[model samples]
Target: MFKPDGNYPLQLHGFLRDQNKIWTLSRENYEALKNVQTHTFDVEGNVVKVQFNPARMTSTSAKVDAASISTRRCFLCRENRPPEQNDFHLDEDFYVLVNPYPIFPEHFTIPLKEHLPQLIEGRIMELVRITSELTDEYVVFYNGPKCGASAPDHFHFQAGNKDFLPVFEKGGIKKEKSIWTKSLFSAEVSGIDDGLRKYILIESGSPESITAVFTHFDQAYRDFRDDDTEPLYNLVCARDGDNFRLLVLLREKHRPSYYFAEGLGQILLSPASVDVCGVCITPRQEDFYKVKEEIIKEIFNEVFISSDQLKKLEEII
Candidate 1:
């Protein structure tokens, strides 16, 4: 479990305390987290929060183009990471480390041990497992390589305090409207239209069953997308009793048109998996103050899968 008797929380806080003393970047980010500005507004019944954290500019303004990515050293790689940062070996292939630029009060970045390209092709089940283990205190999340990952060159997942996400503030699947899709074996896949965002939640107790349903959904999404690569999407996973819930945020675009628009149209905002769940990030102070309900709605509209694309996914059922 992630926070067994809440020891992981203490251990991580200790790591952060130690890192801040020697790791300048980590210290700076921690300071930024303390002073980060935020504003919340109700949008279509969803109270979305916008944050201005200058430390996150690296991620928000990441140049994910192949050429640009190749030219830079992969920071997620062990040798490239700051020496003061501590990590716990999660498995033969992943390491759990505190995220220096944090979104939650206590945030973690779990990266693959091998330096691998970021892709969800075969890793979705791991997300479910991690979430199940940390059910009580934290939620595990994934950022699709093209959707929100700043370190797409290195496969990784992020974890954050569950209380911070607005999604947890809502009720469970039984209380929400959903379009239950055909699932694999005993597993279940259902699309929830939560007015704020379209979410596909996968539920199952068996890892094998969960993997089967997600693998099927992943393929269907790729086939439905126009590009020849993995489709754009954001994901989050948490546990519900003995079962795991995988929330998929189907995306069609990485950034809204306003990201590149001129004058008032431009907002230096980057929508990630967390953002899809109601906590949008604005690296610039001006952008954070300028955010309103209409702009928030527009971002969702641009990034979420179109109605036709979604219908094609339902056809998979």
Candidate 2:
């Protein structure tokens, strides 16, 4: 049942505990979270966390191509979902369920009820609303189809514990000031190129206005890329009081060259919204140990849009 006046975080905690009792896979994975190893690398003064989470191998190495997706059963589909996995109704269109393969201590996947392609063009407002409503306990994020989404065939959003990502930390986005700032409608838009990452930060007190500004920016970005499809990017949104902060991380490619490199050269790392935001996941233990500052720089440099691209995009928007 959906309770508008109830505490969402408390409700989610209850839901998670209930699921763990019935779902052995989810229970085991959540238990395994206790042993997940992590280390940090200082990248240009910003701390980037690298987590050795072997359970994430399924997501890190997912085959999202058209042919592969068509052949496999859609896991997000209601009929195909595991019988033990129950969900809370977020609204008429979506359901909130515990992610069996979790990255956060308390992770949740909110997928649309109808089977739909994972695209954010017309759904930015939905993201804004979800972020705002759940602001008290969680931060919402979206991984673009070609970016980090394992189930690109399904439209969904993910929520994790607030301040879990490094980007929300002191030296992350807070230290990286805006290169360009402008006000469109009732929203404040800023362009940030912090050497390692390029971002479009949008802040607004009103949801409608934020959506309008994002739409305008989206069209400008589409024109800049000259692509009919949605531009490559990942999004993170957090709300504080009446204000909402949305970070749009631009992308040049989905995976780094090392990901495709064979044998010893290979690093099975696939960065999405979470990785771009600062905590990168390496599903293989070897890759976790192999990653260094230079490697992190290389992977980040290869995937994120260049400084010149961000500048041009700023002008276009």
Candidate 3:
């Protein structure tokens, strides 16, 4: 059902090149990336990269509310996709396509062939497997429906160059940095509260073990939140040799108050997997310039689950 010609990165290289030759919107957006401005702020030692990418205004300002979503066609659906856009089948159920609006140098949107809600309850293993297949070249991430996903009506995963997100870099989530650690289903699970963000990390060489632990944690989180819907969170998975490191960034809100603020106080920042990971994107140059260490800390504190909640989750899980 999918190409057997080359590995993912190789196939993606060709796919991107071919798409750029034909897809005007994608080509133009990518070309616009050359002028994107970026700066860094150190929030309690954690470096947060703030990018001024105007092309991302579409996604940054997207309305994923049920009412709003109902009125629009699903952009991820094969029939609804732009005519010039093309896809590389990953499997019978998924297709990999270059992201027209990008934050990473190499970015892709992998969508399920079938139209489905954005949920990750039983799909942790699929994410792990895809991360493994992509090897060390890319990191795969999932934005929970209410977390950061624009297409809340469709199921998908995004992949980007692994080096772009600082959470995977040194000084980010070492075992020693974890506030607490436990072993479940042969996987090592660590809970971290890095002053600004509260997240859970699961590490294991065995995909089965990782999947089992994730399932266990997912239920616990759902129960703790007392919500039927999937818990609000953003997940990042990267393959480390035979082991997979999954970072589940817990969330309390989708967008911070600054996002809805009026006039000069408004900041179009949205915290997603990539944003929470250290690279925050602002589609407006003014917002990017307005962001500072205090703002970063405040935004993170507002969106992420509180230390009390994380402690409770640690005990429950």
Q: Clashes in each model (backbone N, CA, C under 3 Å)?
A: 0, 0, 0
Residue pairs that clash (backbone atoms under 3 angstroms), model 2: none
Q: Which ten-residue region of model 2 has the weakest summed lDDT?
A: 1-10
- Tens digits of per-residue lDDT for model 1 on 1-317? 33335455556567667767887877778777877788888876777889888778888889988899999999889898777887876656788887888888778899999998999888886887677665647888999888989988999999988778887776523325564465666877777665667777777777667778878877776665545687777888877677677788888789888898889768988789888877899888889888999989988888887655554566774
Residue-level lDDT of model 3, residues 1-317, one tens digit each, is: 11234587888888988999998888888888877788988787787899889888889999999999999999999999899889898877889999998888888999999999999988888898888878888999999999999999999999998988887888876566678899989999988888878999999988888889889999988888888889897999998777789989899999999999999999999889999999999998889889999999999999998888887777887
Candidate 1 C-alpha error for residue 293, in Å: 0.4
Kindly list the per-residue Cα lDDT of model 2 for residues 1-317, writing each as its tens digit.
11256567788889999999999999999999878899898886667999999889999999999999999999888899899999898777889989999989999999999999999989998998888768646889999999999899999999998778887875577524677888888788888877678889888888888888889888988888889798887988888777888889999999999999999999999999989888899999999999988999989999998887777776787
Point out where model 2 deviates above 4 Å: 1-3
Off by over 4 Å in 3: 1-5
| lDDT score at residue 24, model 3, on the 0-100 scale | 88
User: Residue 189 in model 1: shift from native, Å?
Assistant: 1.8
Report the error of model 3 at residue 14, Å.
1.3
Predict model 3's lDDT versus the native: 0.89
Q: What is the C-alpha RMSD of each candidate to the true structure, in Å?
A: 2.7, 1.9, 2.0
* Deviation in Å, model 2, residue 3 alpha carbon: 10
Cα lDDT, all candidates: 0.78, 0.87, 0.89
Pairs that collide in candidate 3 are none
Say which candidate scores most in lDDT. Answer: 3
